[model samples]
Target chain A: MYNILEFTRNRSTSVEQTDDKTLRSYCHLNDTIMEAYVEIAVTIPDLEIISVQGDVLRPHKKEFKESFEFLKRVIGTRIGPGILKIVNGLTEGIRHKQFAFMLEECCHAVILLFTKEDLLSSPRPDDEEESIIYHRQMVLDNIRLYNRCAAFAPGSRIVEGIIPKDKDI
Target chain B: MLKFMRNKIVGIEVKDSNTVLAHGFLDDNIYSIEMNVLIDINHLEIRDIDGRWNRWTTTECKRAIPFLKEAIGLRMEGDFSQTVRKVIGRRACRHFANLLLECCYTAKQASEVLKDKFKEKHDVNNVTSENNSDKNVTPIISADMPDHSDTPFHDKPVSFSMVIDLHMHSFPASPCSSVSVDQLIKEAKRIGLDAICLTDHNYVWDRDTVEDLRQKHGFLILRGNEITTDQGDMLVFGMEKDIKGIISLAELRKEVLESRGIIIAAHPFRGFLTVGIQQIGLTLERAIKRPMFKYVDAIETLNGSVTENENRFTEKVAERLGLPKTGGSDAHEVSRVGVYATGFIDKIKDEKDLVDAIKEGRCLPTVFRKHAGLR
Candidate 1:
């Protein structure tokens, strides 16, 4: 059985170390070890990083409604801005899979975001279960590896599609 | 489900093998953007010392709506049985489009490209199961811009490629190994193979041979080399004409960079080639020591020559390192060229364009053949 675990990180600076993280699954479904990190693949001229603070937290908030809004800006503007964001407000509950910080205890959980789009986009897909190979890989990372949304994970948002819920998928 | 959604106006994002792809919606749907398939041609322009993003030269990418429609239309007919066969058909469509672009280069170059394609596919009327399908021979032609080039694939073009090995030789290849260059060329021409790199083991002989073919065919023949090191084997594109001198992996890396070549760790964990991609060579400690994997451009995630597990492991390592992923057919025979080929979305006029695009990290590699990327 392939374990799908979705996670998120706020920003690069916030990420202390990715090598420290590993995906050790319990089902013995092939030890799929996962590692997460960020990268700066492009140079955005005068690119500004809008901090999500104060009144800047709406859907289209100057800062962003939810923190995931930052990813939308990157759609056509820049391709991969592997930015790192700190995961704060751990108390905030998201709608997708259950999300928490510790990797030792949680399995099959996700770094649930406030949006349905986020929920639809974060789970790892079994081979052939998803249409787009790329979208499947992203979901696979979240399932077997790491984050976005509250944290500035490079894979914070995007890649929305239907996913089979069965483990056999 | 994809075919079900007609005109959904789907969006695509292209990225390098190492660059992590991010999306703002559907947290559950985020996917890894393979570097081999990410070619942004619409806004691509080779930058010079003037720091100006000038067009390549004498070309224009007319909205290829009619041809694109026919290609899709044929696929929509729904009688094709083989995935590989259908892929071949799709490849032809792409070749047709590429030939149209070739018209912008030079008359000689354009003719070479068309002739190469025509010659290869000249007599093979039974490629597909139904002989009638071959009757729909569409000849594509156009005029070149000559004084200038058309706009590229994207505003900030990204490129991705798959290594389609159709008639290549390896170090271990026996004397009777496959040398079906004609077959490979035919497939390339039909599939609209953007660039062909003949990295046959340590020598660049294939490069020269392909070059002649390219000059006659109009396809980009990248000077290629497969460096065999104690660490393992590596495949690179865009190099000097002769790959005779013995160069260490480090030196090879430098040389490839100097010549504007892109290096990819082929089949990282499979066979001896593993010694090349993984910093640690044969040990599991490969990625552990480097901690940064700075020497590699991308990882071979899909090697058509090997098993799915090999591809999976390659992808797993790439994902682990956060490096982008790539694929290749690894075919020494021509019939299997595009099996593991790449699709770069750049308005390239020649070899230099591909090398430049790859070096700039404008590439993506993917397994989903139907996934339409950014327009």
Candidate 2:
């Protein structure tokens, strides 16, 4: 139930706490999925993932939805049946990607982490990496926007009051 | 008894001896057979093979198979004992040794629980547990080509270097598979290697050897370890500590990613035993079904010293999958040090960057030595 969502971390990951609304506005610029994920992540005990929310994220990321559905289809399959197809697909994709990395001379990927605690009402297995990545990306853009907005509204207690404790850092 | 030739004029027979219980075929004549004494069934096994001990067994014969095989072996060994020295060649010795080893391994395995299998043989245990258990990847010795080129051999070998063999007990540590770390490094330097991973089975290269060598050679030595999982070997970079027999491949992946390291599939295409590659007997036919390109990262293009067919089979799989492939020496010997290397096209000036480049797939696998190609 505990999480420290990342913002594409660097050496300077904040050791201090900051305002909530400001965080939302910051993550929204990256994508709706992250925004939605972060919005639900904090209230782990209360939030329930409904079809309505799923539909919202589905529209936001068609690729993720397609990948997720295909993954779901493989749940009950015996290891031998779909393993070849899944493995071949993965390796072939990687092969093409490797060639591209050499030719392009660079490589990039966007990864996200989502915890089952936020998605499930009952206890379930959680992937901390997925949750952290999801929240990190979720916070990235919104943090950028919030920083800008806070710069102008310097007097707002919501932004200015979360003191950056030197000791905590 | 089955008859070979019919109507023999042996004075002992009252009737035609060939016409008995079951039927038989001959030169324009058919006959039956029933009574049995001893069978010389060399013909029926595959039909007319000259000198084979092959025979078809009924249910009755099945029960006695184990004892029959042992009896035959003991009889042969005893008969050859008196002057076996003159006739014994490599084959006889090998047969004798393999039998002994099988018996020893079987007895040990039966007495102990499977969990206790890795004890005593610390080096092998470390390698086996750390390199192969609970991992989702099998090392495949295969060659991969880019879409731009269907063939890997069209161009000359690419040149670059990255960490390899970290999981092995380094040269100064335990000498198992091939060469010492020192010899490996020397050979790599001879070829003007930009870097040598210097990793071994499961343990880290002793810190002093690396520190001394790094200061002297001025080449990049990346941190690496080859992990053993249930599926196969995973050549992992930028981590230390034994991850062997501790977690499943699924679990390993989570840790590997979180640690910000790269995990490459080791020799995915070469089949023996590591992953669930079935024993090659009645099960060989089922192999053609698994398209072979299923899971994991960069295939091992050149394993420092396997046969050409092993390498070629791997190459075909990489082509079929269009996967970003890599090569490693899989070297345990010093001479094989730089035999297989990876070329990272990135600005990876050192170990960390090298990992980033490989994880990103900005590399080419190459086999510098012409030791093997396709045989």
Best-matching candidate per TM-score: 2
Report, for all candidates in order, the number of backbone clashes: 105, 66
* Global fold similarity of model 2 (TM-score): 0.39
Question: How high is each candidate's TM-score?
Answer: 0.34, 0.39
Cα lDDT, model 2, residue B234: 62
Q: Each candidate's lDDT (Cα)?
A: 0.33, 0.34
Per-residue lDDT for A1-169 in model 2, tens only? Answer: 1122111100000011123211110111122112111111111111111111112222365543443232222221112111333322322323222121111110000000011112222111144345434333322312211122211122322223322211011
- TM of chain B vs. native, candidate 1: 0.46
DockQ of each: 0.02, 0.01
Error (Å) of candidate 1 at residue B185 is 0.8
RMSD of each: 25.7, 30.2
Candidate 1 chain B, poorest ten consecutive residues by summed lDDT: B1-10
Off by over 4 Å in 2: A1-169, B1-95, B101-169, B172-174, B206-209, B271-295, B370-375
Local error of candidate 1 at A20, Å?
20
